[model samples]
Target: MADLSDATLDELREALAAELPAQAAFDGWKPAAVDAAADALGVDRDVARLAFPGGAVDMIDAWFAQVDREMEARLPAEQLSNLKIRDRITRLLETRLDILAPDREALRRALAILAMPQNAPRAVKLGWRSADLMWRMAGDTATDFNHYTKRVTLSLVYSSTIMAFLDDESDDFADTRAFLARRIDNVMQFEKVKAKWRGAGGERPSLTRFIGRLRYPAI
Candidate 1:
């Protein structure tokens, strides 16, 4: 195999991603999995070190990115165009989980890793990425405070539903879908309350300021 020293990060991620899942089956997202994948690809395991110095955490991030790209391509844009916004959000989130159904064990392990205290930032990043992608695909073009608020609120909903999904064994993820629906409804209710409050002569200025600073990544 040619040395990957000159390769772009995107190229390296593309190459390693193909073998990572199989390796994770044997080693559960440890550096050993990365090494094993490297061997199978006929590249030195250290190549992964060059590609992602953060080790398993970085690999997990790349895996999520890969799935996000797949979800984008596989979802029919025209079909989503006519749906209501709430329905659009539900479809995008459900489609993502469905795409991941075949990799449940790998996802369980990834979630475990992200649950550790040291991995909190990565967990937040992953949630934000998924939520932001959902909004973008739902045709949201907001560039103001609404943009950040939507992403932050969705991130909370996404993260909680993912935890519930990890142990969901129902046929077709019925239980998980119910849980997700409840959470989405709660967020919608909250948004409605906030809108009413905003219309009530700015009675909740402090609350608005607090929510305004919730950070979201640049689109």
Candidate 2:
């Protein structure tokens, strides 16, 4: 794996992707499967280690990166140009889930792996990455603290929607879409409240209390 110190990150990723499907057919994202996948790629099995130093956790991250790339390709600029920001976000997210539909079982396994306590940091990082991708692809240009805040907020929304999606039985994931809409609506309302507070006087205790009550509330 480390033997090819000159190998580019893309090269390692390609090798992993080539080997991943077969391995994923077995144990989702386990190291044993990752190694087998690496071996199947006709490279040094240890190359899997080099490809993903964090083992299965890293593989999960790569998987999501791949999904994001694919989503961007599938969601063309012209298709998004005329939509409202909220609708753009909805379309992009829905497209992502559509792409993942064929691999639902694999996603379930990946989620379970990520749910382990030891992987919490990786899980958070993955969530951030997905949210960031969605915002960028949705045409976000914010560069200030709003950038981080947007990602964090959307991370929560996306996480909850995905959890709902895992068991979604409604036709075409209608339940998941409904859940996502409610979450988005909640955030939009919160944002409206914050904007009014900022415009009104900056730091009203009542506004703060109201905002506090809105976090993660049941829809």
Candidate 3:
């Protein structure tokens, strides 16, 4: 095989340096043997072709474990050093493009609907006040007005959160289960309220059309 160019050799050397030394454990993925088999053999493997000691299965395992580490290291050190940059930019943008008064007013109206006394007729009409409160806490009322326009949005959100919790079967399985239980409780209560509201008033609010038009309102 032709000799690797000086630059290529240097890149391989750096990879070797990274592989040989016990690099810091980043994002819970640690290289098993610091002295890389690839570095020693002078044939470093890129992330795409993560050829590990074992076979294909081993490569898959190693690739998944190293993904987080690789992502963190892929960017230059200077870019990584500016950790607060994103937050600063977001804050600046928020300041520049302030929430329009109309939107705030809309949210305020929704919040008022939620804030009504538990015994208010409008509150009762909406359904169990607890459900509305839960929806508000879910953040559906603020930006999207999803509660008004998407009755099933809260259900979808609950299901999504449950799925996420299930996916995160981390060391603390109990924690995930507990989170799921709380979310399920909220959804159950919300559903009960919905059923009761329909019984009290046979009415189907136009959430579908509202969401559809809201996506691209015809001015």
- Highest TM-score: give the candidate number: 1
Taken over the whole model, the C-alpha lDDT of each candidate is 0.78, 0.76, 0.36
Instruction: Judge candidate 2 against the unseen true structure and give its global Cα lDDT, from 0 to 1.
Output: 0.76
Please, what is the TM-score per model? 0.82, 0.81, 0.22
Per-residue lDDT of candidate 3, residues 12-87 (tens digit): 4444333332221221112333224354444534531333333322322332223323433343345434544333
| Residues 1-219, model 1: lDDT tens digits | 656656776787767875676678668988888888778767766766566678789888878888888888888689799998889989988987887777778888888889999999878888888888899999999897668878988887777777778889999999989988877776676667668876885554343443433222111
Worst 10 residues of 2 by lDDT: 204-213
Error of 3 at 42 (Å): 26
Q: What would the per-residue lDDT of candidate 2 be over residues 1-219, giving only the tens digit for each residue?
A: 444345676777755764564567577777777777666655666655677777777787888888887888899888998999889988888888887777777788888888999998889989888899889888899897568767877877777778888899999999899888887886677667667766896663343343343454576
Could you report the Cα RMSD, in angstroms, for every candidate shown? Answer: 5.6, 4.1, 22.1
Model 1 poorest ten-residue lDDT run: 210-219
Better of 1 and 2 by TM-score: 1
Candidate 3 lDDT score at position 84? 48
Better of 2 and 3 by lDDT: 2
- By lDDT, the better pick of 1 and 2 is 1
